[model samples]
Structure formats: structure tokens, C-alpha cells
Target: DIEMSTSTRGGLLKGLGRKLAGESLFMTTYVCKSATGMITFTPEAPGRILAFDLEAGQSLICQKDAFMAAQEGVSLEMHFRKRLGAGLFGGEGFILQKITGPGLVFMEIAGDVREYDLAEGEVMRVDPGHIALYEPTVDYDIAAVKGLKNVLFAGEGLFLATLKGPGKVWLQSMPLNNLAAAIRRYIPSKG
Candidate 1:
């Protein structure tokens, strides 16, 4: 039952009044400035992405695309990459699409979000899609490590995209893929 104060941007501010919890299965909302279009994450709310709009009146349940917004004078793009050895080798093992944001962005997940400050001359390895937002000044590149024996026997896959930063990074505790997997486990198995 976390609450966020409304913005002072001066418009008809109102809560659409929809109960979007466990019963509803997948919907959440946050306050955003219609003028600035900037929204922040909340703790009580899930850390996964949810649908939102600046112009729409009624609350809507939309797909992944609905959460994207263009702000901070930068364009948003979705980048997808595939992982070869996922669960079997403690990997995500699927194509993950991440939203590249260069502004004040908001994303909702299933648990509390965490922020890490990458020190100067230091770098960190993160799951490709877990990167919520980062400083535009950081450098990024996809690197592939070669080791045939490791891939075949040790199960250590050889490729990963490395992001080096001297900036802030946000990661969501709950990934969308994990959420989907949870739902699948509860559904009646067809086969």
C-alpha cells in the first residue's frame, strides 16, 4: 500500500482507481508529470515494467511497449540479445530486450530496486536486460570469450555484453522472464 504524491505540473490529477494486485495478475501505476513525463519507481510496487500514458484518460493494461516514453531530449530504443546457456548453466538462456533510456525513466518490477555506483576505473558485469538506466557517457561493447572446452564441459558460455561505467546503474530485482516463468508454473499444463 505504498503511495506517491502527485506532481505539481497543474492538470487534472486523479487516480484511475483500479485494483491491480495479485487478483488482477499484472498491472501497476505511478504518478508522472504530464508536463515532464518523468516517473520514479516505488518500493511496495513490483520492479517490473508496467503500462502508462501521458495523454490517455483511463488506466490501461498494455504490453511491454506501453511503458516506454521519450524524454530528457533522448530517443528510446529496444535492443535484443540471446543467451545460449540459461538455466542449465545458471544463465538467462533467451533473447532479452532492454530499453535504452537517456532520461528520467520509470520502470516497475516485482520487488525493491537497487542502485549501484560504478567507481571510477571500475566496471561490472550485469545480465544484458537488467540494466534499467545508465549515464550516457559510459562505454559499452559486446565481448566474446573463446574456450571450446569450457563451453562443452564446464558449461561456461563464452559471450557477454560488457558495460563499463563511471556512472549510476539501476537493476530490478524481478526480471520479466522470471515473472512469466512463475505464471507458467501455475497454469494448467496442456500436455
Candidate 2:
């Protein structure tokens, strides 16, 4: 086990926030004891690892299970997005993981990853499950699927999470939740 610097409420709150996000009860903090040190972390699912720098005053809002590890100075919080449409139909409940940083963070996404840099006023509508992370500057909302025919026959679900940005957003090509549902279709039923 690695020894970590500990502060009473600060340490406990960070772990608690992660737990509320469906993660393990504890966070492993690795302190570099020398000039340089290494720690290896891998998410349980098969996925791509992504890293980013979070400057002061910026926060990264991510999928519930996306966070992997971070430098010591980073902070963890929870976000309950206020978009009612997203809350009801976006698949990822309104509650999400919020990471605040003046530090570096590493995240894991369910499969191959793609990123987009959105200029001011640009927007993207995405399947909520495919959303991995985005800057707080991005405006996240939800939109209804346009036509009844498309909603009922497209198999694309009824609503999508919309991101309007002057910020960056990342998407995962294969969302584990979708993959699991597909795999369930082929599994033999309990006999």
C-alpha cells in the first residue's frame, strides 16, 4: 500500500464523493518519494486511457465511472446536471462526477476515443452514454428526437445530450453500457 498524505475532512470528503459516484470507497493516493515515481492504474473495463490538464478555475465534468486517478492537488465533487430532459432520458442520470483541478487527471473511456474542439456557439448532440468528459464551459442540455418515426424505429432512443461549446468534449466510440446490453442479448437465459 502506498502512504498518502492525509487531511481529516478533506480526505474523507474526496473519498465520499467518489463513492457517491459509484466508485470504490477509497482512493489510492500515490506520492512520489523520489525525483520521479510511478503508479499504474487500469480501469476494469477494456477502454482507452485519456489524460488532461485542469487549470485553476476550470472543472471537468465526466461520466460517473470515468475518473481513474489524479495528481495530489486535484479535488473531487459531484454534479447534478439541471437539464430536466437529460435527467429523465439521457441514460446517464443527472448526477455526474465533477473533477476540479490545478492538477493533472487521468480518465478511462469504454473504447476508442474521439475529441472535438468546439468554437463558441458550436454544439453537438450525443447519446448520453457516449459522453466521457467535457469542460465546464460547455453548455450541456438535452433535445428530443425529432420525429415520432425516428424515435420509435431508429433504436437510437428518444433524447440526446446536447453540448454547446466554447470548450472541448470527448466521446467514446464504444460505451461499455451499450456493449453490455448487446452482449446480454446473446447470453443464454437462466434455465
Candidate 3:
């Protein structure tokens, strides 16, 4: 047997912050009345689900709506981009989801996952939508793609998200936005 109820872990302000960070305001909690019990979670979209066990004070910054589930000790908060360029053209906008942990956290990646570890001062340029997660040590910003021909005919868009790192980063090959746009093309228009 099990009992369940709504949980607002961090109170009103945190709940409000979660809402701004693209998560639900209320979280559900389950209590097991029997000697043993279990629970399961699934991704909201067609994607891969990955889990991380973080030590106290460790944190990960993730793309909006990436959070799936986490243990009770994990904290979710809104992360703001301090750079105007990042805020305006970074693709993820000004606000992102930041999860801090002393426990396990699960995230949903829109498609296949790729992991990279960057040595100090190394940089990687990526399409903004493909960004999945990164350590706080990463310096994130946006830069315009160089060369007129590349910008006009490369089909890679104008701006690229630049990540300078001394830590690990994760990217997803199929972004949800790209998938939605692809599907939208086939939907019949309402006359």
C-alpha cells in the first residue's frame, strides 16, 4: 500500500521559480505504507532518459523542460543568463533550469545523447537547440556564424551557442523544437 500527496518542497517562491523555469508548480509525493515499494517515471516525449547521482553542492544547468524526476534532496531553480547576447539570441532565452543535488536526478534528452569533456580553455560551438546539460564551469554565450556564404547557404542558421569549458557537457541530436517544426509542416492548415 502507498499514500500520496502534493508537495511544494521549497515553498511559494521556489514553486513560482519552478513555474518560470518551465516546470509544474506542484510536485507529488508518495509514501509507502507497505514494507517495500517502488515508483517509476517516463519521459514526456520521444527521447532518452538519463540519470545522475550528484554529491552535495554539485549542480547541472539544463535546457528548459529537461527535468524529469529527482530525489527529495534535489533542488530545482531558475538560472538566468547574465550576458545580453546570450539572453537575446542564445536560443534558450534568458532563463534555464538549474538542478542542484545531494541525490539522484533524471533528465530527458530529446534524442540521442552525446557527452563531451572539455579541457580548460577549450570551446565547442553547437546549434542552440541541441544543448542538453552542462556544468557551471562552462561559460556559455552566443556568436554569429562567420562568412556570408556560410550564413546564407549553410542551413545552420545565424547564431551558434558557444560553450567554453573545463567540464563535461551533453547534447541531444534531435531537439524537440526541430521535431515539432518538422511535424508542423505536414499538418493541414485551417482555412
Top model number, TM-score = 3
- Looking at model 1, residue 109 earns an lDDT score of 45
Give the candidate order by descending TM-score.
3, 2, 1
Model 2 segments more than 4 A misplaced: 1-14, 32-37
Each candidate: RMSD: 11.6, 2.4, 1.2
lDDT of 1 by residue, 32-83 (tens): 5454564444434345453323232211221132243333322223222233
lDDT of each: 0.41, 0.82, 0.92
CA error at residue 134 for candidate 2, angstroms: 0.7
Candidate 1 ranges beyond 4 A from true positions:
1-45, 48-105, 145-158
TM-score of each: 0.44, 0.88, 0.95
**For model 2, where is the 10-residue window of minimal lDDT?**
1-10
The residue pairs found clashing in candidate 3 are none
Tell me the tens digit of each residue's lDDT in model 3 across 16-80. Answer: 99989989898877788999998888887788999999999999999889999888899999999
Better of 1 and 3 by TM-score: 3
Instruction: Give the Cα error of residue 36 in candidate 1, in Å.
Output: 18
Better of 1 and 2 by lDDT: 2
In angstroms, the error of model 2 at 70 is 0.6
